[model samples]
Target chain A: MKIGYLGPEASFTHHAVKGAFSDEEHVPYTTIPDCLEGLITAQIDRAVVPLENALEGSVPITVDYLYHDADVHITAELVSPIQQHLMVHPENESRWEDVGRILSHSHAIAQCHKYLYYRFRGRALETSTSTAAAAKYVSEHPEENSAAIGNSLAAHTYGLKIVEHNIHDYHFNHTRFVVLSRNPILDELRLESEAEKTTLMVTLPSDDRPGNLHQVLSAFSWRQLNLSKIESRPLKTGLGNYFFIIDVEQSFEGVLIKGAIDELEALGCTVKVLGSYKKYSIVQK
Target chain B: MKIGYLGPEASFTHHAVKGAFSDEEHVPYTTIPDCLEGLITAQIDRAVVPLENALEGSVPITVDYLYHDADVHITAELVSPIQQHLMVHPENESRWEDVGRILSHSHAIAQCHKYLYYRFRGRALETSTSTAAAAKYVSEHPEENSAAIGNSLAAHTYGLKIVEHNIHDYHFNHTRFVVLSRNPILDELRLESEAEKTTLMVTLPSDDRPGNLHQVLSAFSWRQLNLSKIESRPLKTGLGNYFFIIDVEQSFEGVLIKGAIDELEALGCTVKVLGSYKKYSIVQK
Candidate 1:
């Protein structure tokens, strides 16, 4: 099997693909859209993309692409603990005060905002396409006055030295990754004990009448079906227009899920099922 | 009266403040947290900040700051149509092919992703703190090879010329700004004809029992109260924990609003009224 992930290798998505599908041949795509497109074109059998972060909330591009741009289905979910480290070129030994610039992906920079601001007060901050790419740039340039924030895997991959370990501001930072495929997972591949989650894209009635969304929620609420998450995204039509992406803690095989959809459609909501899959978590020590 | 807004001047927030409070003396704060801090310190009588955008969804910093950091109340709402333009230094005559780099805020860059990828493919894209800041940088540098994506006001403020108008990927781009004050607006100062919107910060029952959120929504649904918006934000305590920010389409004066709160509290939810205020829209032609 082949897997595609957002990369320049050693990125969090790369780690996710490695952790989830050991021994699989993996290729790195430059962007999230590229990974999805690769899956659609059969350049790869599956794609692992970050869906959300514990601290940053949702990844809008991933959500937006799944909702509007792609015909892919999420087959499985994986969670990985994010550990950001400050790295330098292997041959360069510069004191902390000698550092003139810092580089990382925007989110990594944001996650380490306080540490960076206090330690490297006047240093120039730059964003790269990925954390691994930042590490690669630092490694290739061999600048004594520059450092990169990335993972240990990136340090290993790019032949860089880890100057500081776990520099991320928050300790509980974790990113959720979803495995996407052109076709849904077959029943034979399903794990019986794995927890199921069904994602739905729902558009409420256009009128701002009282109880429109409430009516939609009532369909699941009254059925005792648990909703794990609910997010509102703009329909891109205009202001004040939105559609809700809901994740229910149940599979699509049951009557309850079907009944909820039936009730919602009756109440004038257009519903589309994005996926029904088993949730998985990979804990990195 | 004095007002505070996020600025480096000619920013959307600056425009929002200018449009909404034409007679008030407006001061610029460097960041959203600074604006909120100004309110807490009584440094300004009111502050206007972006709350949400039509294309991008919620402004997380503004929402998170309001919910967690400060005790300020939202007194009014303003909507502004966002128009992004490709701008260059007037003296630097540059054709589209001559542009080697583009600069803007991350959101602005993301908004113009399609246009930039197609027209200025492989160009170096950099992010600044604000779109206006990007324009200022481009103006001061006066490089023929560099341009900026910003608003028309930014072009005027920075003495730059618009190379292309409406360069944003989507047409219906709008930003929603909120007027925040330390003290609630007095009844005498309230406009009777203005439409009301009450924003609420709600924490559903901590236990993940089925129907907890549904029950909370049912409180308003049964009262036939209209909920204009519902957004779920991470509580930051841990993953999978969230609190909802709901905006109702009515003021807090009546029995229905009060009844909804009472019902929610009875159902083991903590509710905080963030504001009850008039809605304002500034249309740019």
Candidate 2:
């Protein structure tokens, strides 16, 4: 199966896709939308995109995209442990203190916030592509006035120095990535027994009234269906409302959940099922 | 008061800091950590750091740094609307069709996820510092195969063309930024009349340990304290615990909140009072 992910190869999304598919060759996309397009046009069999970073929270694009398409299905999930590093040009070793700036993706910079504060004190920090791009920049410049914080592979590829290692403030930092595909893989993967997830995107009516959200959330609680995550995204249709994405531990085909779906659809609102697949566990990482 | 915010000028964070302190001049910071350092050393009277994007979720560093000094206090908060643009070097506009790559901050790249997919089917997408940085990069390396998706100001500054504009999936994309300082600002500001916010940072003993989270949340629910936010940050001291950054509708100094604080502290967990400032409604641009 061909898989799509954001990449220049060493990106965390790439690692996540790699982690999810042990032996499958993955196609690289420059953006998440491209990955989505690949799924829509049948260019790829599956695509993996980040849904939420433990530190960064839920990615709205993933939510919005799911809201945009009713057919896109989430087949599996993966979580990548975010480990940021400081990579600098090897030629600028002794002059490291001369480094006046640091470059990385915004999230990378944000992930290692405390370390940059304590270590760099007052230095210019710019955002760039994957840590690999940051390392590439430092390698091309080879100036002590700049450095980049990224992954270990970035340092090796660009011949950069590992000035600092795993510098993220939180030791348990991790990001969750979701796999999307055009055709629903739930039925095919169900035989594996490990497949145990169902994600749904539901849009409620535009009236700002009481007990609306309670009614929606109760649909799951009443069925004893464990809700994993719930996030809202604007419909952007100027409808003055939002769509909610809910992840349940059990498949939607289950009788109790199917009954809950009926109750939700009967609320005089729009509810669309996104996908059902096996829960990608961290223990598998 | 001298305030620090991520920017060169006209950056989203720059606009946010201006919104936070309309009458004050804010010094531009190249990175979020530099802004945090400025707050730690009193290099600036206060610093504005984007904590969470309504559409994108939390900015990890802002949460991690709350536990840095235990002395740094969040004196105020504000939210700014974000509208991403697709800009390119002016001289390279005729090559739009030939462009094989696009660049911007990862979040910017994510926000314009669908737009990129619909527009460029098989192009390489890259990341940079804000959209402006992407514009700057395209300006420096004017290749027919590259374009940048960012802010309009960046395109103007770098003599880039607006290949596309307002491509973010969500129309109401707003980010919440917090004003932080070394010593808490006890002096009432002109906005005191509108001040109705209470921010607190509490270190929980552990994660998902039944009563730990329930107890802390109950403090607010029991006292009828309207909690606006509850963010989790991994406590870095190897205690295998986490901290909860909670924002309520009432001032921390209020008598009602005082009782809540006592009840929260009695649970054998550490709670640091962050700030109690006037909350202002965010006006979307």
Q: Tens digit of lDDT per residue, candidate 1, span B68-93?
A: 76898988888777788999888765
lDDT tens digits by residue: candidate 2, A151-189:
775676678888777888777666767777776775233
Q: Say which docking band candidate 2 falls in.
A: acceptable
Best by TM-score: 1
Against the unseen true structure, what C-alpha lDDT does each candidate score? 0.77, 0.67
lDDT of 1 by residue, A1-285 (tens): 998987657878787777777778999865566577789889999988877652222266677778777898888888777788998886665564577788886557766756776788667877665687788889888745588998877888898888888887657656778888898772223222357889999998888677778778878988899887887777778766888989899998889999999888888889988888887766553
Shift in Å, residue B184, candidate 2: 5.2
**Model-by-model DockQ, in order:** 0.35, 0.24
Q: List the residue pairs that clash in candidate 2.
A: A30-B125, A104-A128, B104-B128, B195-B278
Among all windows of ten consecutive residues in candidate 2 chain B, which has the lowest summed lDDT? B186-195
Each model's TM-score, in the order given? Answer: 0.81, 0.75
Most accurate candidate by lDDT:
1
Off by over 4 Å in 1: A1-15, A21-49, A53-58, A82-170, A186-194, B1-11, B14-18, B21-49, B53-58, B89-94, B97-109, B114-147, B185-194
TM-score, A chain, model 2? 0.86
Docking quality (DockQ) of candidate 1: 0.35
